[model samples]
Target: MKKGRIILIDDDRDHLRAASDWLTVNGFEVLSFDRADDAFKAIIDQPPDLVLTDLRMPGVDGMTLLSSVVRKCPGLPVILLTAHGDVSLAVEALKRGGEDFIEKPYDAERLVGVLSKAIEKSRMSQEIGRLQRLVVQQDKEVGSIIGDSTAIRSLRQRIAALAQVDIDVLIIGETGTGKELVAQALHYQSHRAPAPFVAINCSALPESIFESEVFGHVKGAFTGALSERQGKFEHATGGTIFLDEIEAMPLPFQAKILRVLQERVVERLGENRLRPVDVRIVAAAKTDLSAEIAAGRFREDLFYRLASVDVRIPPVRERAEDIEQLFRHFASLAARRYGRPEPQVPPSLVVRLLQQEWRGNVREVKARAERFALGLDEEQPQQSAFSIEAPLPERVSHYEARLILAALGINHGNTAQTAADLGIPVRTLNEKIKRYGLRYSGET
Candidate 1:
């Protein structure tokens, strides 16, 4: 294995030599520098695995050098060396991008430990960068969408087919199903690729601000209106405006959006001027708009207008074959973000992942994969239901039973407490205990 390199900078020649010798003996390739300038030059010339610099130097101080290294090589791990009572400066160094700090007159063992951690962190950062670039490259090559499942492939095909056609689109999917991503794929792969892609969440803003947010507002239109502002529609004139959670838009706002769709024009708030706008509308909803219309929450006419080109993204559970592809994609992404090597998703983890009900869908899986990649739970047990060939409900029951028993054990066999913690009634808990025949210590 190639040894990690360390650059140590201190004006004290004896201290530098001692530290270098100690690190070298412990298997690190150490480079010592007496001047801050020399250390910075070495860093720029060939970046080290880790940088250790004294806080105070003769001319160009350690803080300045640390800052320079961080800007030049953001992935480089920098450890600041400060004397006792100068701990505040060390902390400030950390805020300015230094990874850690070692107090002066450092213990040999402590210094080594800190240096080892810094190097590992730096290595991980570098690895994450490499993986992210690979992901970006692969994304471009395979098109922006990230899964290899038949569902995703069909989605890509639809996007490609519809890219040239100028029409309103209605995207329907459950929350966390990457609706915006599909919208972007349409925009990026379309004739409007060069134009802006503006996104708005209809559920995020208040009803009062809806008009001003979607349509430009003139100066003095309302109290506290200091200056004229352009709405998202005006900003997205020649491109695309992605309206997420379109079902949440109130009736009046929906009417305005419908008019924009039909007339290709918008009148700014507090102004009678009708501005002609040429933009593609991609509206997304977590529920069926027709149902909302029937319930009087969404307008029927607006649904027809937006559904000129409708695309439904299936929930993750419905696309079980895509789970592993998505997991690997996220694993690679997380690896890049954390500067760690692309972690292998053990066969067991893949199985557990497939077994998950995934109510939160792809987003939840991405978050879990990220946590796993960061080594938060190295020995996390494989979920039993992931294997498609296995008996699913049986495996799920087995896992659930074990989990309930473990929770009961942790609660010291207190049925009421366990029931409360598990969000079930005491009667239900007692029934389960009997049904599962859970044996507790002190019980026959």
Candidate 2:
């Protein structure tokens, strides 16, 4: 396999020919130029992975060419070929810009090894940058939010529309509903897409460093303050910041967060100056804000501020038609990863899958699909009844609505109490009532 492309330059024709012969024999495409200008002409037409040039030349010396290459392709690695007496100059060239250097009488193996290492390092950096850009591109679309159901389609459209409007957003969803994915889509499609999209898990950050992490800290701000640091807000300036599990944020910190939103700035720890910031907040929580507010665990004011626009991601049960499709997709991916053939789905398994309630939502469905693909789902049980004939989502909603109605009836039409009995939040229960177009008697 060809290692990669390299441009070799030396004023001595014999030296250029020798280096070219050795490199070509060792699996590299060597382009040898006897003059610096000749090599630069080729470098301008098509930049190579590595540049190898002599330190002393008639014109456009090695240092000048290396500087020019550095200016044009900052990431490209350049290695200098120097004489035994020019070791100091070679070291200076490295300090100036060159990646490494080898003496003219160096062994062919040592030269090839250095060249290979430099080219590989350059390629690795290039690959990382490409992948990072790809990740940003993927976030710009609905690629990560997979589903073809009507609810999912409508949600996608709403997300696209919301991306254009710069406003704080509140995402409401059950556990495993891909709330973070929605937040990413919002950031990548917005006008601030080029800026950073920083994500923080509110529940994961402890109280000890919460302030310093969110608002940053100046040097000597507190104990163990080694250097000035940029906080999540500063990193996300002019872009989006995703706060997952917003309900779990400490009450005092929640108040500060609200202030930051209102003030459009943050004061780092031990800093007297407030740095202005332009950021859009996208907050997510699995719990109901209304219940949290009623319970006095969350600030109602903060809720209103973060929820300038609200996005609700429907649970898997509500979009159950996507279950089979999601299952097949995940199974294929798992099979590829595991080096296993795609498992065949039996008709009975299809019925069994749709019959059971996916309590963990899409996340649970994904896990079960991977297990099924690995042939480890034989012990899993299926329960209850819902028609596979009707449009799958309709059947799911119909069954769910019936269950909620029954639960309400059993609880004598008390939504809060019924919600507790059903193991769902009152807010979620109310939304279900509205979605199913149902009314309970003896209720206002």
Q: What are the per-residue Cα lDDT tens digits for candidate 1 across 287-325?
A: 777778888998888888888789989889988988988
| Whole-model lDDT per candidate | 0.82, 0.86
Q: Which parts of model 1 are misplaced by more than 4 Å? A: 1-143, 378-444
The TM-score that candidate 1 achieves is: 0.55
Error of 1 at 149 (Å): 2.5
Clashing pairs in 2: none
TM-scores of all candidate predictions against the true structure: 0.55, 0.62
Lowest lDDT sum, 10 consecutive residues, model 1, at 376-385
How well is each residue in 213-250 modelled by candidate 2, as lDDT tens digits? 99999999998998999899998998999999999999
* Best-performing candidate as measured by lDDT: 2
**What does the lDDT read for residue 34 in candidate 2?**
81
RMSD of every candidate to native, in Å, equals 13.4, 15.3
Model 2: how far residue 223 lies from native, Å: 3.0
